[model samples]
Target chain A: MAFRVVHYINQFFANVGGEEMAHIAPELREGKVGPGMAFETAWKGEAVIVNTIVCGDSYFAEHEKDAKEQVVAWVKEINPDMFIAGPAFNAGRYGYACANIALEVKTQLGIPVLTGMYEENPGADLKDKILITPTANSAAGMRKAAPTMAKLALKLMKGEVLGASCEEGYMPNGIRVNFFEKERGAKRAVKMLINKINGKAFTTEFPMPNFDRVEPGKAIPDMSKVVLGLATSGGIVSKGNPDHIEASSASHYGEYDIEGWDALTAEGWETAHGGYDPVYANENPNRVMPIDVLRQMEKEGKIGKLHRYFYSTVGNGTAVASSRKFAEEYAQKMLKAGVQACIMTST
Target chain B: MVKEIERVGIPVVHMCTITPISLTVGANRIIPTIAIPYPLGNPALTPEDEYALRYKLVDAAIKAFSVDIDKQTVFEF
Candidate 1:
């Protein structure tokens, strides 16, 4: 039996009025509507689209909750084996509606779902959560999108394993599936490094996450009046590392009282970091934490008194997620204590 | 971690040996250091010399903290 499929598209693609018909409520028709013709040709009788859900972009966006429930209830009756939403291209509102409905059908109904959108579409927000094939920024890419989406949709319905995003022409969905590579990791890394040195392009095995860029806080008007707190990811701690923080990949942070301290002496402290040789830091702990000079600044009135407690953690090999957790906890305590500014040191 | 602290609206200056890594990790105000193992003081030098270098670096860090910056600004020592 041919797998039954349900297609979703905006009113514009349904031959309804363009912007003029944008306020129309969702309506469904039996089989092969608009772009469904292209999908039918691509499927080659392996699967047939049994229904197409047509809705206006404007109506869907403004009344999403009701529209979603209404559309979902209707699709539930048809109960397609797979669902396909628009190759919405760069149409923001259309892309958004298609992505949302597609996601809903897959999640709530457990139906195999497929969608396509331009990389910059607002609907791209759902990329990591769905199988979103990449389309061109405009509908001009429709020819390429329909065939690709159809092929993938058929495999999806048959429960066939799919290849990586690059090979299948889809956006990365943040789910990493293991695949064999031609070269060993070390050799690949060496090759990448050599390419980098030669100013040639090489794909990295692990791409760094794009962290949020935080704007710097307003500068202190009078440094002499504000209390200063010290924080370090260099793993400086009291003698014997009372907290036993791991020298590398530290799981926790330590807060210690620096009250009445003139400097971090050899007897009182040592570095708990393992990323580097600990010889010099153990000999004189101030090199990493700079407690000695900070004290001098307090005495010399170069700045206000230092806060009594300082926070420390090991940054080496520490996961960014854990680091965020530790900072969130301590930063609250530091703020409540009226610490106006912070100085962080990392090895 | 420094990013978390600054997100709370408290001004922060990060002093580190690896300036590029610090920037990549999203630090706003940065101060360059001499080495990783000895961020503030170099053991190869005399104690007095080490203290002087440490003082210079810390002073720069303090200045960086006090100065307003619209973006990532590295305070050189």
Candidate 2:
């Protein structure tokens, strides 16, 4: 016997509406609507898309709570063995909505929900664990995502233990479970690099570099009138550097001060940033800190008063959540002190 | 770090040698320098050249405080 499956969707996919229907909240139908039929045909099981809940993008984005609960409730009623959502390609809100719905459904119904998304979609970050397949950037990726999702969903329907995400043609969800038989990332990187250097076909463990662009703000007016702050990722530290900032993904930051025109000397300072060659920083702390030049700038009236303290953090291997929190805290502290501008140096 | 700073209404200028990393990490306004190990003054260059480079990049960074853009803008030296 094959397992029954259900599908979820937004208004655009449901054909109920497009951007106009984006505010349309979740409403379930009895049968396949949009891509659900394609999914139904691709799956091996008696995959029945029991319902299609249509909601608008703006609606879902603005009212995630209502949309998520409604979708979850609708899927719960169906009680299908499997669930699926959009292989959202590059559409930020849609991908996010689908991922959110899929994640919520998996949570409430205890059913595996499968979907696909491009690497660029922020949704992947929020719902990677909820059975997300990596799709290409556009509609062109539909063929690849649809079939791959179907195969994976069918396997889940059979109560199978899924393979690694890459092996299964899915994205790495950042959920690392120890299977007890594998080298660490550092070792794997070394081996693979050696192979590549030797002209062998070695695979890279961490191919994609993680980067997330933040929304840029409007630039301020009157640089000379603004209070300037310094923040460094160059592993700048106090004279003693007590916390021992990691050479990479530094664990802690220390604050220092010089009411006078003193410069950082290697004899008293050390490098804690692990991501790069520490010898340079260890030989001359200014290489990473550039404190010498910044101080000179302050004296020359190129900028307003330098903030009394500079925030420090290591970038290598630091988790995004913690790093963000740290930055927020530092900013809050600076703002409370009347700081109006910042010059952050990254190694 | 730049975003967090700007979130509180303070303008930010990110000086970096790793432009791509900064771009990917979402730095809003950036001023590019000579190198990573030495963002401002490169030890390899003549002291005068190093000072010239550092002074110019820093000048751009300070200038970035006033530049307005609709999207992420990268500064090159």
On lDDT, the candidate that comes out on top is 1
Give one digit per residue, the lDDT tens place, for model 1 in A1-347: 99999888889999998999998899989998899999889989999999998999999999998888988998899988998889899999999998999898888999889999999999989998888999999888989998999899988999999988876767898877678888898999999999999999999867897788888889876788778989999899999999999988899999989998899999999889989989999999999988899999998888898999999999889999999999999999989999989999888
Error of 1 at A317 (Å): 5.9
TM-score for all predictions?
Answer: 0.74, 0.58
Best by TM-score: 1
DockQ of each: 0.75, 0.44
* Candidate 1 stretches greater than 4 Å from native: A62-66, A180-206, A211-226, A235-257, A261-287, A308-341, B1-12, B26-29, B34-38, B41-53, B63-77
User: How would you class the docking of model 1?
Assistant: medium
In candidate 2 the C-alpha lDDT for residue A333 amounts to: 83
Per-residue accuracy of model 2 over B30-75 as CA lDDT, tens digit each: 8777677677667787767765666677778888878887777897
| lDDT measured at residue A230 in model 2 versus the true structure, 0 to 100 | 80
